[model samples]
Target: MHIVVCMKQVPDSAQIRVHPVTNTIMRQGVPTIINPYDLFALEEAMRLRDRFGGEVTVLTMGPPMAEDSLRKALTFGADRAVLLTDRFFAGSDTLATSYALAGALAKIGEEFGKPSIVFTGKQTIDGDTAQVGPGIAKRLRLNQLTYVARIAELDLAAEEITVERRAEGGVQVLSTRLPVLVTMLEGTNEMRRGTLEDAFRAARTQVVTWSAADAGITDLTKCGLRGSPTIVKKVFAPSARAEKAHQIPTADLSFEALAEAVMGEIFARQPAIEGDLMRFSSGQ
Candidate 1:
C-alpha cells in the first residue's frame, strides 16, 4: 500500500499582518509553518502506514524555501518528500493550485508507485476555503470524503475503507473503495515527535524538486494568476466592535435561578427573543 499526503507551508496566523497600502498579506517578515490542520492529516497518514506497512510520501507546492517544510515532514517518518516549485505557479488560487497539484500527483504516481490513498487537511489556515481537496478529487475523478473524523476500518484485500465523517447534524459513517481522497479534520490525532535518528536522516535526505514541466503540466495558461479567476477586492482587519459584552452576575444564586436570571437579561436586551421562545414553546 502507498499513501500520498499533501502538505502546505503557511504563514503563522499569529504573526500574520496585512499590508496597509496594498491590502494584501504581508508575508515578507512572517514566519512560516506547516498548516496546523495538515498536521492531523500527516499524523493520520503516518498511523495508517505504520499499521498497514507501506511508504508514506509527503508532497507540497510552494517556493524554494518551502523545502524546509518538506524536510520537517520527513523527520516525522515520511518515506519521501517531493517539492513542486515553478515561476508559473505563483499567485495561484484554489483552482490553479488544485490543477497543478493534480498534475503533480499523476507524475508522482508514474515515477513512484501508484498511491492507493491521498490525504489532505480539511483546509489551510491562510486559505480556509476548503476547496482544493474536493477540486483534486473532481479533477482526478477520485472518491472524496471530506471532514473525516476517523478511519473506522480499512480492508486492503477487499479494497474498501470506512470512515466516520463529521456532519452538521451528526457523524456519517461512509464506505468507499480504493483511490479515495480524504480531507482529515483537525484534532483527530496528535502528531508524534521525531527521534534524533529520524532528524539526522531527514537532514541528509534529498527532496525531489519538480517544476511545472517536470510535473507534466502541459498548459501554462492553467497554472498561475491567469488560471485564477477569483478576485480579492480588499483584505483588512475587522474593526473593533463598539459594544462590549455584558457580564452576568451569579453570586448567591442557585443554578436554576441563575439560569432564569440569564434568560431574563437576554429577554430584556432583545424582546423579540422572548417572543420567539414563547411562540416556539406554544408550537405556533
Candidate 2:
C-alpha cells in the first residue's frame, strides 16, 4: 500500500505583505512553513503506512526553496520525495497546479510502483480555495474524497476504502475503490518529530527534481498559467469599515440589561423581530 501525500511550502500568513506596486503578495523575506493543513495529511499518511505496512511518498510543487518541505517530510518517515519546480510553473492557479501535480504523480508511480492512495491537505492557506485536490482527482480520474476526517476502513485485498467525510450538517460515510485521492482535514493527529537518525538520513537524501518535460509534459499550454481558467485581474487588501459598532454603555454588566438592549435594537430595525419576540413571550 503505497501512499502519496502532496504538500506545499507557503509564506507565513503573519509575514505576508501585499506589494504596493504590483498588487501581488510580497513573498520575499517571509518565513516559509508547510501549509498548516498539509501537515495533517502527511501525519495521517504516515500513520496509515505504519498500520498497513507500506511506504509513503511526499511531493511538492513550488520554487526551488520548497525542497526544505520535502526534506522535512523525509524526516517524518516518507520513503521518497519529489520536487516539481520550473520557471514555467510560476503563477499557476488551481487548474495548472493540479495538472503539474498529476504529471509528477505519474512519474513517481513509474519510478516506484503505483500508489494505492493519494492524500492532500483539505486546503492551502496561500490559495484557500480547496480546489486543487479535487482538480487533481479529476485529472487523474481517481475516486475523490474531500474533507475526509477519518479512514473508517480499508480493504487493500478487496480494493475498497471507506472514509467518513465531514460535510455540512452531517457526516458522509462513503466507500470507494482503491487509487483514490483524499483531502484530509486538520487536527486529526499531532505531527511527529524526526529522530537524529531520521534527520541525518533526510539531510543525506536527494529529492527527485523534475522539469515540465522531465515529467512527460509535452504540451506547454497545459502546464501553467495558460492552463488555468480563473485569472486574478485585481488583488487588493480589504478596506477598513467606516462605521463602528454601537457601544452599549453599562456600569453593571447585567445579563437582563444586555438582553434588553439587544432586543430593543432588533425590534427597532425589524418589525418581524418584534412579532417574533411577542410570540416567544406567549410561548409561540
Candidate 3:
C-alpha cells in the first residue's frame, strides 16, 4: 500500500501582514510553518505506514520555500516528497490548485506506482476553504472521505477501506475503495519526532521538484489565476461600529434600588417589551 499526503507551507497567522501596494499578503520575513492541520494528516499517514509496512509520500505546491515542509515530512518517515512550484501556478484558487495537484499526482503514479490513498487536512487556515481535496478527487475519480476521525479497517488485499467520518452533528461510518482521498480531522493523532538517522536522511534528501510543464500540464490558460472562477476583487479590513452600550447609573439609596432603576429605565425605553414580559408571566 502507498499513501500520499498533501501538505502546505503557510504564513504563521501571528506574523501575517498585508502588502500596502498590491493588497496582497506580505510573506517576506514572515515565519512559515506547515499548515497546522496538515501536520496531523501527515502524522496519521506515517502511523498507517508504520502499521501496514507501506510507503508514504508527502506532496506540496507553493513557492520554493515549500520544500522545507516536504523535508520536514521526510523526517517523519515519509518515503518520498514532491514539490510543485511554478510562476504559472501563482494566484491559483481552489479549483486551479486542485487541477495542478491532480496533474502532479498523475505524474507520480506514472513514475512511482499509484498511491493507494491520499490524505489532506480538513481545511487550510489561510483559505479556510475545504474544497481542494474534493476537487482533486473529482478530477482523479478517487473516492473522497472528508473529516475522517479514524481508519476503522483496511483490507489491502481486497482494496477496500472503512473509516469513521465526522459530519454535521453526527459521525458517519463510511466504506470505500482504494485510491481514496481522506481529509483528516485535527488532533486525530500526534506528530512524531525524527530520530538521528531520519534527520540525516531528510537533510541530504533531494525532493522531486517539478514545474507545471514537467507535471504533464500543457494548457497554460487553465492554470493559476486564469483558471480560477472566483476572484478577490478587493481586500479590506472591516470597519468598527461606532457607539458604546448605555451605562446604567447607580442609585444612592441601595444596590436593589440601583438594579430596579436600571431595569425601570430599560422598561421605560421600551413599553412593548414590558407588555411581552407580563404576557410571559401570565403563561399566555
Candidate 4:
C-alpha cells in the first residue's frame, strides 16, 4: 500500500501581522511552519504505513524555502518527500492549487507506483477555505471522505476502506474503495518524534523538487493567479471587541452547585434560552 499525504507550509498564525495601511498579511519576517492541521494527516498516513507495511510519501506545493517543512516530515518517518515549486504557481487560489497538485500527484504516480490512498488536512490555517482537498479529489476523479474521525478498516486484498466521518449532528460511517482522498480531522493521532537516526536520515535526504513544467502541467494559463477566478477585494483584521467574560461564583465547588450557578448566569443573560431548554428537556 502506498499512501500519499498532502501538506502545506504556512506562516505561524500566532505571529502573523496585518499591514496597517495595505490591510494585507505581512509575511516578511514571519516564521513558517507546517500547517498544523496537516500534521494530523501526516501522522495518520504514517500510522497506516506502519500497520500495512508500506511507504508514506509527503507532498507540498510552495516556494523553494517550503522544503524545510518537507524535510521535517521526513524526520517523522515519511518514506519520501516531494516539493512542487514554480514561478507559474505563484498567487494560486484553491482552484489553481488543486489543479497543480493533482498534476504533480499524477507525475508522482508515474515515478512511484500509484498511491492507494491520499490524505490531506481538514483545512489550512492560511486559507481556511477547506476547498483544496475536495478540489483535488474532484479533479483526480477519486472518492473523497472529509472530516474523517476514524479509519475503521482497510482490506488491502479487497481494496476497500471503511471510515467514520464526522457530520453536522452525528457520525457517518462510509465504506469506499481504494484510491480515495481523505481529509483527516485534527487530534485523531499524535505526531511521533523522530529518533536521532531518523533525524540524520532526514538531514541527508534530498527532496524531489519539481516545477510546473516538470510536473507535466500544461496550459500555463490555468496556473497561478491567471487560473484563479476569486478576487480578494480586501483583507483586514476584525476590530477588537470590548466585551469581557463574566465569572460565575460557586460556593464549596460542588458539581451540582457549580452547574446550577453556570446555568443561572446563562438564564440571567438570555431568559428565553432557559424556557427553550426546559421545553426541550420536557420533549415539548
Candidate 5:
C-alpha cells in the first residue's frame, strides 16, 4: 500500500506580478509556497497512509529550490521526499512535464517499492491547466480519477479503492483497482499542522535528488523546450474598464421592486440578454 503524492512549489498568486513591458510573470522577489491544491492531495495521501499502514512518498519536479516543497511534505508526515531536477527540464509544458514525471515515477518504483496509487492536485495555481495529472496517467497507462472529493473505501486485501468524484450537477461514486492515479479536488480536507517532532525530523532528513538521467530519461528531444509544443505568444493583464459599475438606489424598494430594478438594469446594459431570456422562457 505505497502511495506517491505529486507536489509543486509555486509563486504565491496573491503576490505575483507581471512585468509591465514584457507582460511575463515577474518571479523575482516573489515568495514561493506549496501549491494550495496539492496540500489537499498530500493530506489525503497521509490520511490513507495512516489508515493503511504504509509509507507515503512526496515527489516534485522543478529547480533545486523545489526541495523546499518536498521537505515541507516531509513535515506533514510523508515518509520520504524525492526531488527530480535537471537543466533539460526547463520550460516544459504539460506534455513534457508528464513525460519526465512518468519516467521518474518508473525509476521510483524500481528503486523504492512500486506505488499502488499516485496522487496529485486538481491543478496548479500558476499553470491552472489541469492537464499534467491526466497526462501522467495517460503516459503511465494508469487508471485515472479526477476531481475526487472523497475516498470512501479502500480494500487493501482486494486491492481496490472507492471514491466520490465531483461531477457536473452531482457526484459519482467510482471504484477502481490498485495502480491508479487521482487528482484530488481542493477543500476536500484541511491540511494538518506538523508536530514539533515531525518538523525536527523533516529538517534533518535528506531529500533524494535525481536528474533527468538519474530518472531514466534519455531522449533529450522529449524533455524541455524542444519537447514542449505549446508556445506562449503573449501574457498580459486585462485592461481596466472605462465605465464604473452602476449602483441601484434601494432606499424604499421592496424585494419585488428590487428584483425588477436589477432585471431592468441588466436588460438596459445588455438588450440581447432580455431577448435571450424571453426566448428561453418561451422554450426557444
Candidate 6:
C-alpha cells in the first residue's frame, strides 16, 4: 500500500505583490509556503498510511526551492520525498505541469513500489485553476475522484476504495479500484505537528532530486512554456472602489431608533430591497 501525495510551494498570498511595470507577480522578496490546500491532501495521505500500515511518499515539481516543501512533508511522517526540477520545466502551464508530473510519477513507480493511490489538493493557490490533478489523472489513465470529502473505506486485498465525493447538489458516494488519483477538498482533516523524533529524521533525510531526463521525459517540446498554449497577455490588480462605507451613530439612539435608522439607510442605498422584504414578509 504505497501512497503518493503531490504538493506545491507557492508564495504567501498575504505577502505577494504585483510588479508595477511588468504587471507580473513579484516573487523576488515574497516568502514561500506549502500550498494551504495541499496540506489537507498531505494529512489525508498520512492518515491513510497510518491506518493501513504503508509508506507515504511526497512528490512535487518546481524549482530547487521546492525542496523545502518536500522536507516539510517528511517532518509530517512521510517515508520519502521526491523533487522534480529542471530548466526545461520553466513557465509551465497546467497542461505542461501535469505532463511533467505524470512522467515523474512513472519514474517514481519504477524506482520505488507502485503507488495504489495518488493524492493531491483540489487546486493550487497560485493557479486557482484546479486542473492539474485531473490533467495528471487523464495523462496516466487513472480513475479520478475530485473534491473528495472523506474516504469511507479501503480494501487492500480487494484493491477497492470507497469515498464520499462533494458535488454541487450534495455528496456522492463512489467506489473505485486501486491505482486511482484523488483530489482532496479542504477541511477534510487538520495537519498534525511533527514530533521531535520526526523532526530530527526529516533534518537528516536526503530528498531525491531528479531532472526531466531522470524522470523519463523524452519530449522536450511538451515540457515548458513551449508546450503551453495559454498565454497571459496581462496581469494586474483590480482597482479599488471609490465608494466609502457609511457609519450609523448609535451612542445617543435607543435600540428601536437605531434599528429604524439602519433600515432607513439600507432603503436609501437600495430602494428595491424594501419592496423585496415586504413581498417576503407578506409570503408573496
lDDT of 4 at 183: 99
Give a tens-digit lDDT track for model 3, residues 162-266. 999999999999999998999999988889888888988888888999999999987878789998899988787655578777878663658888878878997
Off by over 4 Å in 3: 18-24, 244-284
* Tens-digit lDDT track of model 4 for 77-181: 898999999999999999999999999999999999799999999999988999999999999988999999999999999999999999999999999998899
Runs off by more than 4 Å, candidate 5: 242-284
The C-alpha RMSD in Å for every predicted model, in order, reads 4.1, 2.7, 3.5, 4.4, 3.7, 2.2
Worst 10 residues of 6 by lDDT: 231-240
How high is the lDDT of residue 245 in model 2?
A: 86
Give TM per candidate.
0.86, 0.88, 0.86, 0.85, 0.87, 0.92
Clashes of each: 0, 0, 0, 0, 0, 0
Model 6 Cα displacement at 109 (Å)?
A: 0.5
Error of 5 at 128 (Å): 0.6
Q: Higher-TM-score candidate among 1 and 2? A: 2
Note the Cα lDDT for every prediction shown. Answer: 0.93, 0.89, 0.90, 0.93, 0.93, 0.93
**Candidate 2 residue-wise lDDT, 1-284, digit = tens:** 89999999998998888876677787788999999999899999988899999988899999999999998889877888989998889888988999999999988889887888999999999879999999899999899999999999999999999999999999999999989999999887889987788788888889989888888876778767887788888767777699988776766869899889887787777979878878899994
Query: Candidate 2's C-alpha lDDT?
Result: 0.89
lDDT of 5 by residue, 170-205 (tens): 999999988899999999999999888889999999
Q: How many backbone clashes does candidate 6 have?
A: 0
Would you give me the overall lDDT of model 1?
0.93
By TM-score, the best candidate is 6
